[model samples]
Target: MANFISNAFMIPNDLIDKGYMKKMKGSALPCYVLIVRNTRGWNKTTDSMSISQFVEQTGYNKDTVLKGLNTLEELGVIAKKSSKNRASEYTLTDSIIAVDFLDSEKLDSEILDSENGSGSEKLDSKMGSGVENLDKLLSKNSTHNNNIKTNTKTKGNFSEEFEIFWNAYPTCKRKSDKSGTFKTFEKYTRVISLEKLIAILNAFKMDSQWIKNDGEYIPAPSAWLNKKHWENDFWLKAAGLVEQQPQSAETPEYANPQRRHIPTMPKRFKGMNA
Candidate 1:
C-alpha cells in the first residue's frame, strides 16, 4: 500500500491536464499512464510493465490495461518497445505536461472512499480560487504558469500535497466563524509566505498570525478590527503592497459612507496640555 500510494498518489493532476496524459483515455490508458509516470521520472529510459503484470498489480482486467497502454502510445505521451517480448516499454514525451498528471483528477469527495475523507479535490478547488486570484494580483500575469508554487512549496521540497495539507496553514477548520477577523488571516497563513506576511504586518503595524504562537503576539478578537476594506488597502499600500481597485461599486473598499474605508489618523496640536 505504501508503494502503491507513493507511486499513484504522488503525481499531480495539473500535469496530466496540461496534456501529459493526452495519450488516450480508452480502457485503462489513464491508469497505465499513471503507472508508467509513477515508475519513471523525466529521464525516461527503456522501462516496461506488462499487461498481465499491470493488471495483477492494479487489480484491473488484462484487457483494460492493454487498452490503456495502447491509448497512451497512440497519444504519443509514451513510446513502446520495438520488440513485443519486452512488455511494451514506454517513455515520457514531455515532463512538464506529465508533471501535471497529478492535477488531472479533481479529487471530488464523492469520488473517493469515505473512510478517511480525503476530499482534497474539493479543498483545493475552494482554496485555489483565492490563491489563483492572489497570484494574479501579485505577479500581474494571467498566462497560467504551469509550475506556480504555492506558499507551501516555498518553504520546503516535500511533496506538494503533503506541504499543502500538513505544512500549509489550516483554512477549513475556521470557516464557520465567518465574522471572525482571522478568517482571511487564517487562510492566508497557510498559503502566504513569511516575506509577504512580514510585509503586510509591517505595513499595518500588526503582527502576523502564525499557526503556532511563540508567545510574542496573539490574534485579537474580530471585533477589535474595523470592517472596512479601503482601510486595509491603505495599510497594504503603506507596506508597499498594491491593492486592486474593487470591481463593483458595492464593494466595501471604497471611501464613500455606503462603503467602508480605513480610518485616518487624527490631526493634533503639539503643545495643547495645560
Candidate 2:
C-alpha cells in the first residue's frame, strides 16, 4: 500500500524542484517548515511569528530558531519584517507548501542520488555543521544559566532563613498564611536588607500596637510584610518611640512679656549721641 496523508496542506513543487531544500540543510529546514505551516497552512500569504513561538513549535532553542530564520532569509525562501514589540511578519515565497508528509525523496534527483558518493558526503557535511552549531548553542546557554545559579541561594538555604524569621516574629492571637508569608519574606528582604528587616521585626517584638492585649491585634507575618511594617518607627527605638530630631543647643528665650527687663531708657539715650 502507498503511504498516504488526508489532513494536509500544499507544498510548492518548486521547493524541491528548485533545490531550496538542499541549501536549507540544518536548522533552516525546520524553521522554513514552521513558516510554511503558519503561512501556507493557514491559507494566508503572510503571518507573524516570534522566536519564542518557533522555539515552542519546533522545540528548538532561541539561538537555533534565530539561525534558521537567518538562513531562510539569506536563501530568499521567506521575507521577514520586524514589528515593534510584536512577532516578526513572515511571508513564505512558496504558495503551496502544505503536503501530507509527501515523499519529497521521490521528487528530488539529488535526494534520490543521495545514496551515491558525492551527494552522501555533502549531506554528511551539512548535518555535521548543524550538530556543531546546536552543541555550541547548548553550551553557551548552559554556561549563562550556571553563572546565574552561582549567585543565587538555593531554595533550601532560603527556606532556612525564612524559618529563622518566622520564629522571631511575635506570636499573635492566631497565625495565618505560613506559605504566603514565606513568599512575602523573600520579596521583603529583597527591598529591605534582611539585617534591617530582622532588626525591625525584633523591635516590633515589644511594640504596643503588636503586643497590646497579649498580641491579640497583631497581623499575620504576610500581612505585616505586605503592609511594609518594617518601615515603621516602632522598630527603631528602645521603647517603640518615634525617632526624634536632635534639638538645637541654643536656649529658647521665655515668651512671657512679664519677664522682659526694662532698660532704663538706655541711660537717657546717651544724651543724643554725646
Candidate 3:
C-alpha cells in the first residue's frame, strides 16, 4: 500500500546499443518485461500491487505482461503468490543483493549490551538523557540476554516476512499503535533522494556500501535513514533548503540545571550607562 517505484522499471536507452535485448535468452526480453520494470521503480513494495493495476499503470497487454511477470519470477528476482480468488502480488527477491540486514552477532551483542551494559552501550547512554522510556525498554528483562545464538549463514539477511518496516513509520518520528513496538527487520529500499539519504546515513555513521547489489546500485530501506533531528537539520540547512536553528539556552538537556555552567564574575564590574 505504501508508495514505491522499482529501479528495474527504468529501462535505459543504452540497453539497446549494448545488444542487451539480443543477448537476453528465452523470448529475448519480452515487451511486458520492459513495461512492468518501467512502471515500477527499484524501491516499490508489492503487497498492494495487482496484475490489473500493473497493466493499467504500464499500459501493457495483460497476457504479455503476465508472461513477462512469469519470466521475472523464473529469473528468481521476484516471487509471486497465487490466490484462489484475488489476483496475486509480487515481492522483490533481491534483498540479499541490496540491504545488509544486521547480523545476528551484532543484534545479540547490541541487545545484551543495552540490557546489561555491553556492545552498543554508548548509543544507549546518549539516548538515556532524552529517551528514558526507551532506555528502560532496552535495558529491561535482563534474563533475555543469556540466549545468545549466532547464525553463520544468515549474516543478518532479513526475511521476506519483514518487509513492513520500510513503510510503517515516518523517517523522523517513531510512533506506536495497538500492535506494540514498530521495530522491524527487513531490507531497506533506496527510493528517497540520494542527497537526503546520504546525509541521514552520515549522521548515524552507517556505511552506504550496502546499497550496492550484484555490482549494481539498488534502492535502500527507510530504516537506514537516521532519526536524529538536529543532525538531519544540520545537513538540510547546508543544502540551502532550510535554515538551521542555533542552540539556545532553551535547548532541552543543555537547559537543565544539571547541565548549566556557573558564570564567573569579573573582578572589576563595569558601571551601567550613566
Candidate 4:
C-alpha cells in the first residue's frame, strides 16, 4: 500500500538556519515541527500533544520523545504544564519570538539594500541613510541579545531552586508537575523562603509515616505545594510527637501484655496449690 500526502505543513527556515534545530538532538526537531504544524498559525505559540501522539506521529519511541521534550524544555524552547489527570500542555518560549524579530529585521534590511541598489546616484545619496539603518539594526540586535541573556539567567535561577526542592521531597511520583510546582513556589515566595521550604521538606522526608512503605503516603510535589502541606503538622505527627495518645492506667493487661506483671506463686505452694 502507498500513502499519499493530502496535507502540507509549513516550517520556518530560520528555525533550522538560525541554529535552533542544530542545537536539538534526535527527535526534537521532528516533534517540534509536528507541534508547529498542528498549531493554528505561525503566530500561535502553544500546542498540546501527548506522548502517545508524538510516538504515533514521529515514529519515535517513548524514551526518544521524552528526551526530545526534556531537551526542548531545558533549552527554553518550550514550557510545559502537566496535571494529575491531563496531558502536558506545551507553549513555545521567547526564543521563537526572537527568531521572528530577527527575520523581520533581515527582511527590512534586504528591502532597504534593494531600494538603494536601483541606481548608483540613489545609492550614493542613501549611503548615509543605509548606515543609520545598519546602526539601528545593530542596536536592536544587541537589545534582543540582552533580553535573551536575562531570560536565561532567570530560568537558570528557577531551575536551581526547584531542583533543591525536588531532591528534598520524599516521593518521585508526579514529577512531571515540576512546572506547576515551580509556579506555586513563585506564588508563595513572599509567604515562605525556599530555604525554609527545603528544611521543612527534609523534615518530612525523614518522617516515619512519610517514608513508610517507601513513601507511599507522601503527597505529590504539586499537591503538597498546592495544599500548603508544609505548614501542616504531618511532620510532627510522623515524628511520633503529635497525634499520639497516652496509655491509660485502666487499660487491660491482656491489651498490652508487654506492660503486664504477674506475681509468682511461692515455691512451697507451687505443687500443693490446685
Candidate 5:
C-alpha cells in the first residue's frame, strides 16, 4: 500500500472536459493549481493567498497574477472571499467539480446501507440521518446553481455595455485591458448612466485634440475611463468652443510673441510720403 501526501490535491477530469480549463488562460491554471494544493485537506471554501505569495510561487509578475485571479473569478472557478492590503482570501467554487461528483454512487450506496442496521452504525452516526443529509446537500447545490446563473447574467450585461464603450472610444490602442476597463466603466455608470457615458465618448471622439496627429495624444481606453478624462476641458477645445493657441507661421504673434520684434517700417519705406 502506498501512502499519499496529506497535502496532495486532485483536479477533476470534468473541469477540463467541460471547458472550464480553457477559459482560464496563461498563468491562471498554475496559480489555481497552487491554491488548490494549499487547501488540500481543508474545506475548499477557505483557500487563500497573498499577492506576494502568488508572485513567489508562480514566478509571474504581480499584474499577471492579478489578471489570472480575475479571470478565474470571472469564469466562476473561484470566489474572492475577502481582501486586505495586498492579500486576498479566495475559495474554489462548485463549478470546479460536477454536481454528480458530490452524489457519487459509492456515497449513495453507503448512505443507503446506513439506513439499514446491517451497515456500520458509525457511518449512520456520523451522517445523522443519511436521507436528510442528502436533502441538505441537494438544497445547497441548488442555491449554488442559482447564484451561478445570476453571475452569468451580470457578466453578459457587462460584456454588452463594454462592447459599446470599446466601439465608441476614440482610439483602439491599449484595448487589451478590457476586464479592468469594464470594471471602471461599471463603477462610473453607477453615478452616470451608460447612455450619458456613450454620448460623452461620442462627443470626445470627434474632438480635434483626439483626432489630431491621428490620435497620437489620445489616452488609452483604460486610462481614459479610469481617470474620467472625458470630463476635462480639453474636449471643449476639441468641439471648437474654446479657442486653442495658434501654432502656424501666420500666427507668430500668438505662437512666439516674445520673438516677434516690432517691425520698424523697412528703411526704404521710412521716408515715403503716403
Candidate 6:
C-alpha cells in the first residue's frame, strides 16, 4: 500500500521491456497513454474512447488519431469494439501488458452514465477539473479588461473638461494640437482651479490687446497653455485704447479708430510705465 504510486496510472513493465513507447512514438504513444489512463487508471479493463476525445488527448487531427488507433490495433497493443450509438470501447492486449496481468471485470453499463463505460463517476471528475480551470481563467481576464476600460473612461472625462477652455479662447489659426493642449491644461489646473482660470480667460476676451488686430497677437491654444502668460494680473493688465493702430486692412482700427486699436508697446510692457 505504501509503495503504490499516488496519482499515477498503471502500465505493465513489459510495455517498456518491449519498447512500445519508442515504437509507437509520434501518433500512437499518446493514444495508448490516454486509453491506459481511463481504463487501468480507474481499475477497469476497458473504456469507450471517441475520435474527438482522441483528438483532444493527442492534439492530433481526426485522420491522424484514427490511423494511430489502427496501428495500435495492428500491433496487438489494444483491441477496439463499438456499438451503434456508443463511443468505441478499447482494451489493452497482451503485447503491451494489461490484457493478461490485470483482473477483468463485468462492469455495469452505468448507475448514471460514462464514456469510460466503467459505470463509475471517474470520467466526470477528469472533465470537471478542466472546465473549472477554464472558467477561472476567463473570469480573471474579464476583470482585467474591465479595469483597463475604467481608467480610460476616467482620462476621457478629464479631456471633456478641457474643451471648455478650448472653446472660450479664440485664436488667429485653427487648433492643430488639441492633445498636447489638453495635457498642458491638466498640468495648469493643478496650479489654478478651473473656475479661476475660466474667469481670467473671460476677462482676456474683452482686453484691448486681444480685441485689436483681430486676436492676431493672441498665442495659439497649445502655446498659450504652455507659456502660462495668462497668469499674474493678466486681466488687470488690459491695454487701453491706442492712437497709433496699424494701417492694415486686417486691422479694424484702419477702417475706424473706434472699432479697435493697439499701442506701440506690446502686451508685456502694459502697465509698466517709468
Give the candidate number with the greatest TM-score.
5
Superposed model 6: Cα runs more than 4 Å off: 1-3, 98-274
Worst 10 residues of 6 by lDDT: 99-108
lDDT of 3: 0.41
What C-alpha lDDT, on a 0 to 100 scale, does residue 170 get in candidate 1?
27
- Model 2 misplaced stretches (Cα beyond 4 Å): 1-6, 95-274
Model 3, 181-242: lDDT tens digits are 21222112334432343334333332244223431332233223333333456655543446
Q: Estimate each model's TM-score.
A: 0.28, 0.34, 0.25, 0.34, 0.36, 0.34
Candidate 5 stretches greater than 4 Å from native: 1-7, 41-44, 102-274
lDDT of 4 by residue, 1-274 (tens): 1452213334556676767888789999887876665442223446545565576568798999999988888878678888653446788654543444334545556557767674455444455455556445545434222123355545333443454465445545556666677777778777866655655565666668776787777777877777765466775454333457787989787786785578998676346555
Model 5's number of clashes is: 0
lDDT of each: 0.44, 0.62, 0.41, 0.61, 0.62, 0.61
- Residue 103, candidate 1: Cα error in Å is 20
Expressed as tens digits, the lDDT of each residue in 181-223 for candidate 2 is 8888888667775545655665666577876788888888888
Candidate 1 RMSD computed on C-alpha atoms after optimal superposition onto the true structure: 24.8
Q: Rank the candidates by TM-score, best first.
A: 5, 6, 4, 2, 1, 3
- Can you write out model 5's per-residue Cα lDDT over 24-94, one digit (the tens) per residue? 89889888887665553232445545555566568798899999998988888788876543236777765
* lDDT tens digits by residue: candidate 6, 32-59: 8888766655445577655655765577
Indicate the TM-score of model 2.
Answer: 0.34
Cα lDDT, model 1, residue 256: 48
